[model samples]
Target: MTVKDSCIVEAGTLLVGVGPDGAMERRYDVGIRVHEGLIAQVGAIEAVAYGNDHLPRYGSRGMIAMPGLVNGHHHFGLTPLMMGVPFAPLELWLPRFRAMRQIGNRLDTLYSAIEMLESGTTTVHHIQSGLTGTPDNWHAITSDILGAYDEIGMRAGYSFMMRDQNILAYEDDAKVLAALPEKVRDWLAPKLGAAATPTADYMDFFRAIRSGWAETSPDGVRVNLAPANLHWCSDESLQLMSQTAREAGASIHMHLVETERQAEYALKKFGHTAVQHLQKLECLGPEVTLGHGNWMTPEDLDIIAGCGCTMCHNASSGLRLGSGIAPVNEMRARQIPVALGIDQSNLADDRDMTLEMKLVWALHRETGLFNDRPDAAAVLQMATEHGAKSAGFGGLVGRVEPGLKADIVLMDEKAMARPFVSKRTPVEETVLHRGGRHAIDKVFVGGRLVVDGGKVISIDREAVMAEVAARLEAPETAAEAADWEMVNAMMPHLEAFHRDHPLVGERRPYRFNRITP
Candidate 1:
């Protein structure tokens, strides 16, 4: 297909992110003009291209146009549940991740990317994980992941997972190894061994990636730094990551306290909360995005807001892994930017941002009072504008306005507003409550049609899914099967350790009330 000079997206209802008063606005019978991969004009159809009707027109009547959804944090690989790993708490689940068989990097990336695109997500903050091997090998893997995104025409932010210590346990690898039986210890040594690359070496590789890809990649691709999580990385490693990110003008994303065990570990190891430790290390800044902050306290929220940092709420992942719900309402009340992410753990087991937005809106409605619930507009912002900023694409692709990248989604208004509500019913409200992947008619990234008629145009989705399914069903080696069995056997011991070391501090409770007694 040849690229055109200009195109028009004509919509019956348009939810523009900004209005004449600099607030979110809704317009009717609007046509958006695209030229050179950016929004050229936005107004009534007559004003955009009146007499000259030769330009390619994209949308049709009964179609609604809005900014493409942004997934603030995600792993560009297969979900663990799909790989035969049952959902467990974060600590127990981390070890089992090693036991899962490795599928080809390209296939896994394309598999997840297709799921995201088909669900109307045009931008993603892809946090790379399971990276191993020498520097050249890492480069090859990273390139392959980014190549898939480039071919699929989705905006992406890439960051490699970095960690130096505590591969298996919060206290020390040696301590955990000592507790296991000799046979089990020997079997896990290779899997949970010391870090293969030094902190300095990881920093060097990060610089190499920036020079090799960030400088020359397309308009939507960026490379950033991820220090994995608080328990997984040492203080020195976190400091280096922060320093490198600041020097390179890159962003940082890390998992904060996602579980009660992790919060307890922070108190035991650092004599403070994880958020405070990061603050002391000078890691809190506007460029930093904390992932799955399920255990953030009120003080932590205040500190995060003061530092100008943001949080990526993975509501489904938290629920799947039994991680407590995040204080999203409190975070918002404090004026901290909270974005939404699938984290490869949605209720539907696919990367559906619409469902994610709906889950975020519904999960936090703790009280039945309408006044204390999250409104449709707030959830939409978290999925779009706030998400864009968290993924380092702020002001570039989250809004449907002139001079901004034309990353947008078109939904069938009739399909969304089914059963015939009054004409005065707000389109945004309908979209948030009733919309799903089936309603997404088309998606555009950089003004290019990536999904049309509920199908991705850039790649063969059925073929890719077929290939991945076959690979997943392939016979596993004895060693691979044995590793999974051993990990399964080891879960009891790990659970005992956590049960003994409960959290000890003035921490927020996961639940507010108990059954009436």
Candidate 2:
């Protein structure tokens, strides 16, 4: 229909990342029709557009309408896990991760959801991990987390922590055997179970659980599986996770070349980069999303793009752990899809994506995030459509328009982002570089309000914080506390290991999981 035939819901400005070409348009007097939560009508001032006649209309007011952002890769359990910690590099950080309390239950997950929504991230690809305490426990932990997301009215793609080999990132035998009074080992023995159970059993159990969750709500949760992470998973385990996700019709999220050490191992053991090996294994495709793909060779990036896979970059975690920035600009130049993630910030302590995106600007020159400085709009897209696409929505999300999920955020312009009245200024500049969470007035998903006025509409934030505090105080009781203590206490041993086992000098069959003919 032409503009004359349409009813416009004229807001101050309408930002539409329309079409696969990503043509962005700003129009006034735009009307939208919300039929079953999708924008059924879009046109100029005379046209009627989204939402119900009974609901609040955009009217002539100046609201910068834009698509909601997506967080393509994450580990929700890290919040409580990061309550308090000593700072260290990745090799040292992994050890600390072993002992952090699994304080993130349904409520904590909801709290994290609140923070993301407040920041305008409506969709999240939750790459959960460190959940293996006992049988059915893993399912319980993940399901509880997703339940919070559903109740909070956020859209999420849930990838489970599928580690066939390491149920828990257990301490090495030397460390455990030395410190574990036989009493502690015996106490944990029954829970550990026999070591020889087929890995498929774990896969089957989680798949059944995923199917059940999908059958139940299906809207809020996208349950997929992947190995716990590269360092934490074996080659067979990675292939099995990939195969399982394929059979289950679910997406995958795995850590690839996250650190210098991990990259070093792939070269030494596998005779190729981890990404190259996985590519050889036929695992790089739309069905897979690689989280924290740092240290990739030019060839590795090409393979990822050729397969139409996504590289979910975690900017916060990289800086905190001293891992180099992802070559985002290289991927963009090659037309590879890139998405944003928070990574282990709950412990390492950076959850805000606004800061994360800016980091792209600060270090892009070094990492080749862009040949020229990336424009604000480009960085915003990485946080939104690029992120949504990585989560498998492609063009269906990360934008405000017809035929897309109405994952949206309304910014309180009256707050910090002042003088937004100019018709010439781009909204991307305001949202990406200026507006902060305090400016978030409302957040929506599928046309549903999840967070309003910077507060969660569903859960009690105060109560959630209380539970988090309680869990944080007693990280010692849980297995996580023990693990962190063990890892840190043995820093000397790990340091010694690092001297010989430098992260740079490694590549083994397990590390380089390729399906040889």
Candidate 3:
């Protein structure tokens, strides 16, 4: 099948951008002309295709056209919860992740891609969690994942998470292992050895992936660096990641202060906060994107703002994992760019950016009548423009404007106006308050129709789901059983390590509660 070179996208109402007065700038009955995957012109439908009436068209007079959503910080396709890991605090949940059965890379990635596309997410920053194997194994699995995205036609920013310490807990590996029983320790020590890949290999892996993607899908896919977390990475790893990212002109998305204990770990280990230590290593900068900053202090915020780093807020993940609320309001007040992510743990256990947007809008409201909080427009920005920045796409996407990639979402205006929505209500508010995957009529990435009639057109969704079900239904393999046993054996020791670790520092309260004044 031959692909078209140009097409006309018609919208009943198009979200141009935020206006000077802080309202959504929408144009009625607009048309966008996309050629060679980039928007060539945006104006009246007749005007855009006046001379060339032969161009294929998408959307209609009943759909709302907006920039495709971005998931700034996502881990994997099959969620941990779906794999039988129940929700727990971040510290406790980390250990249980070891028990998750491995689903094939392509199938798992395609599963999440469909979910995201159905929910209007056209781009994602995929921060890969740990994968143990040789460099060749890493390359093969990474390729399979990226190939899935290519098949689904979704833009992606891929980063392999880098860590050389504290693979299972904030405490040192030796200390945690020492605290375990002899039987458990003997079995676990060999397993940990296989998981340890040299830090230099991580750098080489990034370079190899970057070079490969540059030739294949340079604009549609980006390769970046991710130093897993403060407690999980050494000073040398952070510095090397920072320097490598700068030299390569790539983005670095690292997990930082996701929980109160992580913040405390920094203070006890380095006599400073995590953000301060990042500064000390010269890792805090514009090219850096920090995931979760849920436990950041005012000083940390100030430093982050000065360094011009982006923060990807995983609203649902924080609530589900019991990692307290991020200082988004404070970050906004400091004029720092904020992005939204599902973190493979949205409230619905699905990758729906619309629902995630609603959560962000409602979760940060202060108690007082006049207290500042996220508005519909602000939350929309986080899912689009800000998210693009966090994912290293920057100005290439996140706006429905000419000179940008034609990644757009067509919302069913009829569904949005279901029963009755006042014409006075802004499209931003309507989308933020009421929109869901059901409202996503269609999705287009790079001027290609990837989803039509609320279904993916690029691949067979039903077939993929069936394959996944088949794999999941089978009995556990010997390797998987052993891994589960190791996880079960280590859980108590990990819990005790976290509970009794020496990093007991003062944690600032952030979650809403009944007690006040």
What digit string (tens of lDDT, one per residue) describes model 1 on residues 175-256?
A: 7777777777888787655345787898898888888775656476778899988988988889989999999888898988
Per TM-score, what order, best first?
3, 1, 2
Q: Model 3, stretches more than 4 Å misplaced?
A: 1-5, 19-21, 505-517
Clashing pairs in 3: none
**Model 2 residue 349 lDDT score:** 57
Error of 3 at 472 (Å): 0.5
- Model 3 residue 140 CA deviation in Å: 0.5
Worst 10 residues of 1 by lDDT: 508-517
Which regions of candidate 2 deviate over 4 angstroms? 1-10, 18-23, 49-52, 56-60, 77-82, 164-197, 346-350, 365-373, 414-423, 470-488, 505-517
Q: How displaced is residue 144 in candidate 2, in Å?
A: 0.9
User: What would the TM-scores of all predictions be?
Assistant: 0.94, 0.84, 0.96
Ranking by lDDT: 3, 1, 2
Please provide, for model 3 over 1-517, each residue's C-alpha lDDT reduced to its tens digit, 9 standing for 90 to 100: 1232478999989987666665777888989999988899999887987986888988888889999999999989888878988888887887787789888889989999999999999999988886578888998989998989988889999998878999767767888899888878998887688878888888988898899899888788899999999998989988988999999999999999888778788888899989999998889999998998988888888999999999999999989888878878888989899999999769999999999998888888867898778899889989999999888889989999989988899998889889899998988899888888888888889888999999998998999999999999999999889878878887887788777864654544557311121
Q: By TM-score, who's the top model here?
A: 3
Q: State residue 200's C-alpha deviation in candidate 1, in Å.
A: 1.7
